[model samples]
Target: MLSVESLSKSYGKKEIFKDISFSVQPGNIIGLVGENGAGKSTLLSILATLQSPEKGSIALFELDYKSKKREVRKHIAFVPQDIALWEDLTVEENMMFFEKLSWKKKGKEELKQLCSNVKLDRWNERVKTLSGGMKRKLNLAVSLIHDPELLLLDEPTAGIDLKSRKEIGNYLKKLALENGKMIIYTSHDMDEITNLCDQIICIGEDPFYQEILTETGKNILSF
Candidate 1:
């Protein structure tokens, strides 16, 4: 559902990615890996339409990103590494706010169901009162209010407890396998990469590596 061609980015003399190209199809989970300061987040930001690359082209389902960002954004949801919640708002309030922003207007039951899916069960709890893991789950749930076709999660499971991490992993797997969402998430954990992704892509340097991690009973998403 996505194609990137010869993407390059730089800040003054320093460069990020150069000539990086890859494609991700529906039901595919792309695990992006690189060392710190490798521009993993930068790439995600470009894909999220928060920033434009110095040079390159991105196409989402054949729709050019540069010229069609508004249309492209409707089909994409981004969960960044940082917690993006109103500290004073109740969890349910946050969901409702984003729902309105997306103009999806999902009903209470559906929103709660999404929260349940992400293990954010306390609807009336304020954001500042939640644990780190719960906050991450809430961040994830907010992004899914519109059910975008492509999901970009930056360090989704980072800093969470083991149980919460596992919960996030299973939920993401279900999103790709059952709902056919194309997911690209960054992680420092190779185990998470092997367990969750259909492919592993290592960025931040030349000779970009994209390798299929498994061919077991997985439902491969054809490009």
Candidate 2:
């Protein structure tokens, strides 16, 4: 399980998060939702270990992110808000580079299988030549190549076509259901949150809310 306790951050005098707490179990999909500048990205960054919070801590399973940064990172994969890939590199080359950096070697068949699973089979094209949706797909493929236990996505479906959104959503759902990987995604799209997440954590300053939604109904709270 992933646990966040009283996570707080500040930029000079401006406070981003005051005291946030949440937990995500295996096979759970959590949505981080808020308006712009509501600290959604900051919170995700803290959870991803890209940055540290001024107060509080995060734990994946039994590993503490603060003390076991490297170990924690190995179990988590973060897809940033922007597409961070080498535009000059071919799609397959990008994936291969990331796979190698992950220090995990797979047979040729497994590598091909990973590409097919992410629907990047025809990825010989350069990343710069691919469409926005295709680039996002490749980004997700690279993040999952190491098979991290937790996947953190920051507005991954933003600015993509509807078809791509659905495809990515389905793939993430499959990973959680079939592979038992935990997923935490952040987005401002209410429909995406409603459809893809089992629980929603709403963050803001004046008013904050957190809700857990199931097929039947929702449990809501205000903070």
What C-alpha lDDT values do all the predictions have? 0.86, 0.82
Q: Candidate 1 at residue 179, lDDT?
A: 96
TM-score quality measure for candidate 2: 0.92
TM-score of each: 0.91, 0.92
Local accuracy of candidate 1 as per-residue lDDT tens digits, 7-70: 8999899987788888999998998777778888898899899999999899999999989989
Q: Give Cα distance to truth, residue 71, candidate 2, Å.
A: 0.5
Clashes of 2: 0
Model 1: residues with Cα > 4 Å off, grouped in runs: 205-223
Instruction: Note the clash tally of each candidate.
Output: 0, 0
Candidate 2 lDDT by residue in tens digits, 1-223? 9998888899999988788888889998988877688888888888999999999888999899989999999889899879999999998788788878884676556767776776666668999998888888888888877789999999999999898888889989999999999999898777788888887777774342333333315432222
